[model samples]
Target: MNIHAAILWEQGAPLSVEEAELEGPRAGEVLIEVKAAGVCRSDLHPARGDWPTRTPLVLGHEGAGIVREVGEG
Candidate 1:
Protein backbone atom coordinates (compact mmCIF):
# COMPACT_ATOMS: atom_id res chain seq x y z
CA MET A 1 0.00 0.00 0.00
CA ASN A 2 1.12 3.52 -0.73
CA ILE A 3 0.78 5.98 2.14
CA HIS A 4 2.04 9.32 3.26
CA ALA A 5 4.77 9.16 5.87
CA ALA A 6 7.27 11.33 7.70
CA ILE A 7 10.61 9.82 6.79
CA LEU A 8 13.97 10.49 8.32
CA TRP A 9 16.57 10.55 5.58
CA GLU A 10 19.46 11.05 7.95
CA GLN A 11 20.31 11.46 11.60
CA GLY A 12 19.77 14.94 13.12
CA ALA A 13 17.69 15.99 10.17
CA PRO A 14 14.03 16.85 10.07
CA LEU A 15 11.63 14.28 8.72
CA SER A 16 10.51 14.65 5.17
CA VAL A 17 6.90 14.13 4.26
CA GLU A 18 6.40 11.88 1.28
CA GLU A 19 4.65 8.93 -0.18
CA ALA A 20 5.86 5.50 0.92
CA GLU A 21 5.07 1.98 -0.12
CA LEU A 22 4.13 -0.48 2.64
CA GLU A 23 4.03 -4.20 2.60
CA GLY A 24 0.90 -6.15 3.39
CA PRO A 25 0.46 -7.73 6.80
CA ARG A 26 2.37 -10.91 7.48
CA ALA A 27 1.33 -13.75 9.77
CA GLY A 28 -0.45 -12.65 12.94
CA GLU A 29 -0.47 -9.04 11.80
CA VAL A 30 -3.07 -6.46 10.93
CA LEU A 31 -3.21 -3.42 8.68
CA ILE A 32 -4.49 -0.16 10.10
CA GLU A 33 -6.03 2.86 8.45
CA VAL A 34 -4.46 5.63 10.44
CA LYS A 35 -6.73 8.37 11.70
CA ALA A 36 -4.34 10.38 13.84
CA ALA A 37 -0.62 10.65 14.59
CA GLY A 38 1.43 12.49 17.18
CA VAL A 39 5.07 13.34 17.86
CA CYS A 40 6.19 12.68 21.40
CA ARG A 41 9.41 13.24 23.35
CA SER A 42 10.66 9.82 22.39
CA ASP A 43 10.26 10.68 18.75
CA LEU A 44 12.31 13.82 19.27
CA HIS A 45 15.09 11.87 20.92
CA PRO A 46 15.94 10.16 17.66
CA ALA A 47 14.97 13.05 15.43
CA ARG A 48 17.31 15.44 17.14
CA GLY A 49 20.14 12.91 17.09
CA ASP A 50 20.04 12.44 20.86
CA TRP A 51 20.10 8.74 20.03
CA PRO A 52 21.48 6.93 17.02
CA THR A 53 19.45 4.87 14.61
CA ARG A 54 19.75 3.68 11.05
CA THR A 55 19.01 6.19 8.36
CA PRO A 56 15.75 6.43 6.47
CA LEU A 57 13.48 5.72 9.41
CA VAL A 58 9.79 6.24 9.89
CA LEU A 59 8.54 8.41 12.74
CA GLY A 60 5.35 8.77 14.83
CA HIS A 61 4.27 5.78 16.85
CA GLU A 62 1.69 7.52 19.01
CA GLY A 63 -1.47 7.50 17.01
CA ALA A 64 -4.94 6.12 16.52
CA GLY A 65 -6.11 3.96 13.69
CA ILE A 66 -8.72 1.46 12.61
CA VAL A 67 -8.00 -2.10 11.67
CA ARG A 68 -8.47 -2.53 7.96
CA GLU A 69 -7.27 -6.07 7.40
CA VAL A 70 -5.83 -9.07 9.18
CA GLY A 71 -3.25 -11.56 7.99
CA GLU A 72 -3.71 -15.27 8.09
CA GLY A 73 -1.70 -17.46 10.41
Candidate 2:
Protein backbone atom coordinates (compact mmCIF):
# COMPACT_ATOMS: atom_id res chain seq x y z
CA MET A 1 0.00 0.00 0.00
CA ASN A 2 1.03 3.56 -0.63
CA ILE A 3 0.50 6.27 1.93
CA HIS A 4 1.09 10.01 1.88
CA ALA A 5 3.81 11.08 4.25
CA ALA A 6 6.08 14.00 5.04
CA ILE A 7 9.62 13.02 4.16
CA LEU A 8 12.61 15.08 5.25
CA TRP A 9 15.24 14.38 2.65
CA GLU A 10 17.59 17.16 3.67
CA GLN A 11 18.44 19.25 6.67
CA GLY A 12 17.10 22.81 6.96
CA ALA A 13 14.82 21.98 4.05
CA PRO A 14 11.09 21.74 3.86
CA LEU A 15 9.40 18.43 4.14
CA SER A 16 8.08 16.83 1.01
CA VAL A 17 4.66 15.32 0.89
CA GLU A 18 5.12 12.17 -1.09
CA GLU A 19 3.52 8.84 -1.61
CA ALA A 20 5.47 6.23 0.31
CA GLU A 21 5.16 2.53 -0.22
CA LEU A 22 3.92 0.56 2.75
CA GLU A 23 5.05 -3.00 3.26
CA GLY A 24 2.10 -3.65 5.52
CA PRO A 25 2.41 -4.82 9.06
CA ARG A 26 4.29 -7.84 10.27
CA ALA A 27 3.38 -10.00 13.21
CA GLY A 28 2.02 -8.00 16.16
CA GLU A 29 2.07 -4.85 14.10
CA VAL A 30 -0.60 -2.39 13.06
CA LEU A 31 -1.24 0.30 10.48
CA ILE A 32 -2.62 3.71 11.38
CA GLU A 33 -4.48 6.28 9.37
CA VAL A 34 -3.29 9.62 10.67
CA LYS A 35 -6.05 12.14 11.20
CA ALA A 36 -4.14 14.79 13.08
CA ALA A 37 -0.53 15.52 13.97
CA GLY A 38 1.26 17.75 16.42
CA VAL A 39 4.08 20.16 15.69
CA CYS A 40 6.84 20.02 18.27
CA ARG A 41 10.44 21.10 18.58
CA SER A 42 11.62 17.54 18.21
CA ASP A 43 10.23 17.38 14.71
CA LEU A 44 12.08 20.55 13.75
CA HIS A 45 15.30 19.34 15.32
CA PRO A 46 15.93 16.85 12.58
CA ALA A 47 14.67 19.19 9.91
CA ARG A 48 17.11 21.92 10.89
CA GLY A 49 20.02 19.65 11.76
CA ASP A 50 19.70 20.60 15.38
CA TRP A 51 19.64 16.91 16.20
CA PRO A 52 21.89 14.37 14.59
CA THR A 53 19.00 12.50 13.10
CA ARG A 54 19.03 10.44 9.98
CA THR A 55 17.95 11.87 6.68
CA PRO A 56 14.83 10.85 4.81
CA LEU A 57 13.07 10.39 8.11
CA VAL A 58 9.38 10.30 8.71
CA LEU A 59 8.50 12.98 11.24
CA GLY A 60 5.39 12.00 13.06
CA HIS A 61 5.68 11.11 16.72
CA GLU A 62 3.06 13.43 18.14
CA GLY A 63 -0.18 12.74 16.41
CA ALA A 64 -3.55 11.16 16.60
CA GLY A 65 -4.90 8.63 14.18
CA ILE A 66 -6.97 5.53 13.73
CA VAL A 67 -6.11 1.93 13.35
CA ARG A 68 -6.44 0.87 9.77
CA GLU A 69 -4.76 -2.50 9.47
CA VAL A 70 -3.36 -5.17 11.71
CA GLY A 71 -0.88 -7.94 11.15
CA GLU A 72 -1.62 -11.59 11.35
CA GLY A 73 -1.75 -13.02 14.82
Candidate 3:
Protein backbone atom coordinates (compact mmCIF):
# COMPACT_ATOMS: atom_id res chain seq x y z
CA MET A 1 0.00 0.00 0.00
CA ASN A 2 1.04 3.60 -0.50
CA ILE A 3 1.52 5.92 2.45
CA HIS A 4 2.83 9.40 3.06
CA ALA A 5 6.39 9.50 4.28
CA ALA A 6 9.11 12.07 4.79
CA ILE A 7 12.17 10.84 2.94
CA LEU A 8 15.68 12.14 3.37
CA TRP A 9 17.33 12.04 -0.02
CA GLU A 10 20.80 12.93 1.22
CA GLN A 11 22.77 14.47 4.01
CA GLY A 12 22.14 18.21 4.56
CA ALA A 13 19.15 18.03 2.24
CA PRO A 14 15.62 18.91 3.26
CA LEU A 15 13.28 16.03 3.85
CA SER A 16 10.82 15.39 1.06
CA VAL A 17 7.34 14.23 1.77
CA GLU A 18 6.11 11.71 -0.72
CA GLU A 19 3.85 8.78 -1.17
CA ALA A 20 5.77 5.66 -0.35
CA GLU A 21 4.87 2.09 -1.17
CA LEU A 22 4.82 -0.11 1.88
CA GLU A 23 5.24 -3.82 1.57
CA GLY A 24 3.46 -6.08 3.98
CA PRO A 25 5.41 -6.81 7.12
CA ARG A 26 7.15 -10.09 7.63
CA ALA A 27 6.60 -12.41 10.58
CA GLY A 28 6.33 -10.69 13.96
CA GLU A 29 6.17 -7.27 12.35
CA VAL A 30 3.38 -4.77 12.70
CA LEU A 31 2.05 -2.11 10.36
CA ILE A 32 1.33 1.15 12.11
CA GLU A 33 -0.82 3.98 10.83
CA VAL A 34 1.31 6.68 12.33
CA LYS A 35 -0.67 9.55 13.78
CA ALA A 36 1.93 11.70 15.46
CA ALA A 37 5.62 11.67 14.56
CA GLY A 38 8.19 13.80 16.37
CA VAL A 39 11.22 15.30 14.68
CA CYS A 40 13.85 15.57 17.36
CA ARG A 41 17.53 16.43 17.31
CA SER A 42 18.34 12.74 17.42
CA ASP A 43 17.04 12.43 13.87
CA LEU A 44 19.41 15.20 12.83
CA HIS A 45 22.29 12.77 13.32
CA PRO A 46 21.58 11.19 9.96
CA ALA A 47 20.93 14.51 8.27
CA ARG A 48 24.24 15.82 9.52
CA GLY A 49 26.08 12.66 8.37
CA ASP A 50 27.06 11.91 11.96
CA TRP A 51 25.13 8.65 11.81
CA PRO A 52 25.48 6.46 8.78
CA THR A 53 22.16 5.61 7.24
CA ARG A 54 20.88 4.40 3.92
CA THR A 55 19.92 7.12 1.49
CA PRO A 56 16.27 7.93 0.98
CA LEU A 57 15.63 6.92 4.56
CA VAL A 58 12.34 7.48 6.28
CA LEU A 59 12.99 10.20 8.85
CA GLY A 60 10.63 9.55 11.69
CA HIS A 61 11.58 7.15 14.47
CA GLU A 62 9.83 8.56 17.51
CA GLY A 63 6.18 8.11 16.71
CA ALA A 64 2.81 7.48 18.23
CA GLY A 65 0.17 5.70 16.25
CA ILE A 66 -2.38 2.95 16.07
CA VAL A 67 -1.82 -0.58 14.95
CA ARG A 68 -3.19 -1.02 11.48
CA GLU A 69 -2.12 -4.58 10.78
CA VAL A 70 0.10 -7.31 12.11
CA GLY A 71 2.09 -9.94 10.33
CA GLU A 72 1.60 -13.60 10.93
CA GLY A 73 3.73 -15.46 13.40
Candidate 4:
Protein backbone atom coordinates (compact mmCIF):
# COMPACT_ATOMS: atom_id res chain seq x y z
CA MET A 1 0.00 0.00 0.00
CA ASN A 2 1.03 3.58 -0.54
CA ILE A 3 1.50 5.76 2.50
CA HIS A 4 2.56 9.29 3.25
CA ALA A 5 5.66 9.11 5.38
CA ALA A 6 8.18 11.53 6.75
CA ILE A 7 11.49 10.10 5.72
CA LEU A 8 14.73 10.84 7.46
CA TRP A 9 17.39 11.06 4.82
CA GLU A 10 20.25 12.07 7.08
CA GLN A 11 21.19 13.26 10.50
CA GLY A 12 20.87 16.99 11.18
CA ALA A 13 18.82 17.30 8.04
CA PRO A 14 15.28 18.26 7.28
CA LEU A 15 12.64 15.56 7.02
CA SER A 16 11.40 14.80 3.54
CA VAL A 17 7.72 14.09 3.08
CA GLU A 18 6.95 11.61 0.38
CA GLU A 19 4.72 8.78 -0.69
CA ALA A 20 6.06 5.39 0.33
CA GLU A 21 5.21 1.85 -0.53
CA LEU A 22 4.44 -0.25 2.55
CA GLU A 23 4.11 -3.96 2.62
CA GLY A 24 1.68 -5.84 4.82
CA PRO A 25 2.92 -6.81 8.25
CA ARG A 26 4.64 -10.07 8.88
CA ALA A 27 3.50 -12.70 11.35
CA GLY A 28 2.37 -11.34 14.72
CA GLU A 29 2.45 -7.87 13.34
CA VAL A 30 -0.38 -5.46 12.76
CA LEU A 31 -1.00 -3.05 9.95
CA ILE A 32 -2.10 0.30 11.30
CA GLU A 33 -3.65 3.14 9.40
CA VAL A 34 -2.00 6.09 11.04
CA LYS A 35 -4.55 8.75 11.95
CA ALA A 36 -2.36 11.06 13.96
CA ALA A 37 1.39 11.52 14.37
CA GLY A 38 3.25 13.95 16.53
CA VAL A 39 6.65 15.36 15.67
CA CYS A 40 7.94 15.64 19.18
CA ARG A 41 11.47 16.28 20.37
CA SER A 42 11.89 12.61 21.07
CA ASP A 43 11.85 11.97 17.36
CA LEU A 44 14.58 14.56 17.05
CA HIS A 45 17.06 12.61 19.11
CA PRO A 46 18.15 10.67 16.09
CA ALA A 47 17.60 13.54 13.70
CA ARG A 48 19.92 15.74 15.68
CA GLY A 49 22.64 13.05 15.71
CA ASP A 50 22.17 12.46 19.41
CA TRP A 51 21.07 8.91 18.79
CA PRO A 52 22.04 6.40 16.17
CA THR A 53 19.47 5.51 13.55
CA ARG A 54 19.21 3.98 10.16
CA THR A 55 19.13 6.56 7.49
CA PRO A 56 16.28 6.81 4.99
CA LEU A 57 13.92 5.52 7.63
CA VAL A 58 10.29 6.34 8.28
CA LEU A 59 10.42 8.85 11.13
CA GLY A 60 7.11 8.67 12.94
CA HIS A 61 7.29 6.31 15.91
CA GLU A 62 4.83 7.90 18.34
CA GLY A 63 1.60 7.72 16.44
CA ALA A 64 -2.02 6.97 17.14
CA GLY A 65 -4.13 5.01 14.70
CA ILE A 66 -6.54 2.19 14.09
CA VAL A 67 -5.56 -1.31 13.20
CA ARG A 68 -6.50 -1.99 9.63
CA GLU A 69 -5.14 -5.49 9.30
CA VAL A 70 -3.51 -8.14 11.40
CA GLY A 71 -0.93 -10.62 10.29
CA GLU A 72 -1.22 -14.28 11.15
CA GLY A 73 1.22 -15.96 13.45
Q: Candidate 1: where is the Cα deviation over 4 Å?
A: none
Of 1 and 3, the candidate ahead on TM-score is 1
TM-score of 3: 0.90
Model 1 agreement with the true structure over 21-59: per-residue lDDT tens digits: 999999999999999999888988888898988878888
TM-score of 2: 0.85
RMSD vs true structure, all candidates: 0.9, 1.3, 1.0, 1.1
For each candidate, the alpha-carbon lDDT, in order, equals 0.90, 0.87, 0.89, 0.88
**Collision pairs in model 3:** none
Candidate 2 contains a number of clashing pairs equal to 0
At residue 50, candidate 1 shows an lDDT of 89
Q: Write the per-residue lDDT of candidate 4 for residues 19-63, one digit (tens) a residue.
A: 988999999999999899887888889988999988987776788
- Point out the worst 10-residue segment of candidate 1 by lDDT: 52-61
lDDT of 1 at 24: 92
Instruction: Give, for candidate 3, the lowest lDDT window spanning 10 residues.
Output: 52-61
Best by TM-score: 1
How many residue pairs clash (N, CA or C atoms closer than 3 angstroms) in each of the candidate models, in the order given? 0, 0, 0, 0
Candidates 1 and 2 compared: the better one by TM-score is 1
